[model samples]
Target: MTGNTNSIENAGDPPRRDQSEPRRVHITRGLVDVLLELAEENEPSEMNVVLDATPASSFDATFDLDPETPILTHFYLPSAGQSVRKVFGVDLGTPAGRGRARFLTHPQGPFKLTERDDFAAVVLLAVPPWDDDTLGAFDRSGRKLELVVVDAEPPVEEL
Candidate 1:
């Protein structure tokens, strides 16, 4: 892999782990609180966040997963005008089906690997109808990527 080669390879791919490996979103209670606070402020619409996914250390005796686990930890609020498309730098901000706008979807559809996926880990999507927030992970190439959800320790102090 060369300089740009790595970036190109990462596009449309997970940042830390192989697509074939299992995944679990390790977010902190504080992160969830912040997201909820943003949602409440914005009231319904959607707030999308892009974050770097890194491998988290595990110490559970019963914890059994390959070391290749990629933890999606993107948890933050977007600025006044920032958007996923703008951040990703693809398409012309085209909205998806059902008149809902601003969803992070691959313009060419999933599994279409590019340099972007290699670097970008995941986009935290917060939409209305937030009740059913859990969706089992899936590969962009269309395979069932199993997921595990755990409340992680806050990455930062709650000053």
Candidate 2:
């Protein structure tokens, strides 16, 4: 006398994963434009922006740009277990007699004068996972942009 135990549980339901877990998120140029619009509206002194490596991956990160120090900070790469380089330079073309000069560049730092009306913007380039063959096959750079507004006030502490 065997009882039937072969019935499937929630067969029609989609698989569920923990929402709190750090998952990969795709950040497209269009999404960046939407974020820019949102940032323009609020103009928060400081804000925290997070980016996921993919949709179902365990790579998550955050970036911050401080206007007070006028420096970019709090860049985390969990997968790498460290923070990335803060400053970078680019060639801006040389003068008639001047040699090739490098312009101070902080791609993930404060926004340029032209990019904002009242708020400064920070641009970050996120490289995709090197181990991801599928992603690497299409795009070697795997660059994504993340923007955060620096906050004016400090966080309150609980005593």
Candidate 3:
């Protein structure tokens, strides 16, 4: 019933980061603000967003990560559910599929990731509509991202 039980493809589950991997993620406060803003814009309906990430060391469109490398979230944009499900249906021939730092906001409650969510996303969320100060980021496996809010976004034009 298992071949590489941890593989995202094996169970169609999101790839998990074990204790050996870097658990901390640094994201810009600006990005969180954007999420809250999007939430307001999409309120009454769940909002989905695609965020751009760069490894503190190395990263790729494939989202394969080095055990020791950390990640940072900078730029993000509003996305549709189907677009994210298909990586925007863009030509994956280039780095256009480069972001794994995607998000979906549920105006519901606390953070809880589910099977229906796009495996590549790490829903960094804040609730109560106006509470941008409170935020949470989690992966599909229920492991939390030790989030650090930074002051600025990266200089990349797009992801």
TM-score for each candidate, following the candidate numbering: 0.41, 0.21, 0.59
Better of 1 and 2 by lDDT: 1
Q: Candidate 1, 13: how far from true, in Å?
A: 17
Model 3 segments more than 4 A misplaced = 1-22, 55-76, 79-95, 130-133, 156-159
Residue-wise lDDT of candidate 3 within 17-131, one digit each (tens)? Answer: 5776746666666677767776777776776566666554443333334634445555444433445558666533224666676666667765666666665646566555545
Better of 1 and 2 by TM-score: 1
Q: Which digits, one per residue and each the tens of the lDDT, describe model 2 over residues 1-159?
A: 246334365455676676444322233333344334433443433222322222112112232312222222122221231222222332222223321111112123332322332221223321212112101001112222222232222222247
Q: Which stretches of candidate 2 lie over 4 Å from their true place?
A: 1-26, 55-109, 112-159
Distance (Å) between predicted and true CA of 25, model 2? Answer: 13
Error of 1 at 148 (Å): 2.1
Please provide, for model 1 over 1-159, each residue's C-alpha lDDT reduced to its tens digit, 9 standing for 90 to 100: 676745766888766656556644444344455554655565534344443333454423223445455444443334523465578764333322211111132322232233453222333333343322522233444344443554664243245
The C-alpha lDDT values of all candidates are 0.41, 0.27, 0.60
Q: After superposition, how far is residue 72 of candidate 1 from its true place, in Å?
A: 2.7
Steric overlap count per candidate: 11, 9, 0
lDDT score of model 1?
A: 0.41
- Best model per TM-score: 3
- Candidate No. with top lDDT: 3
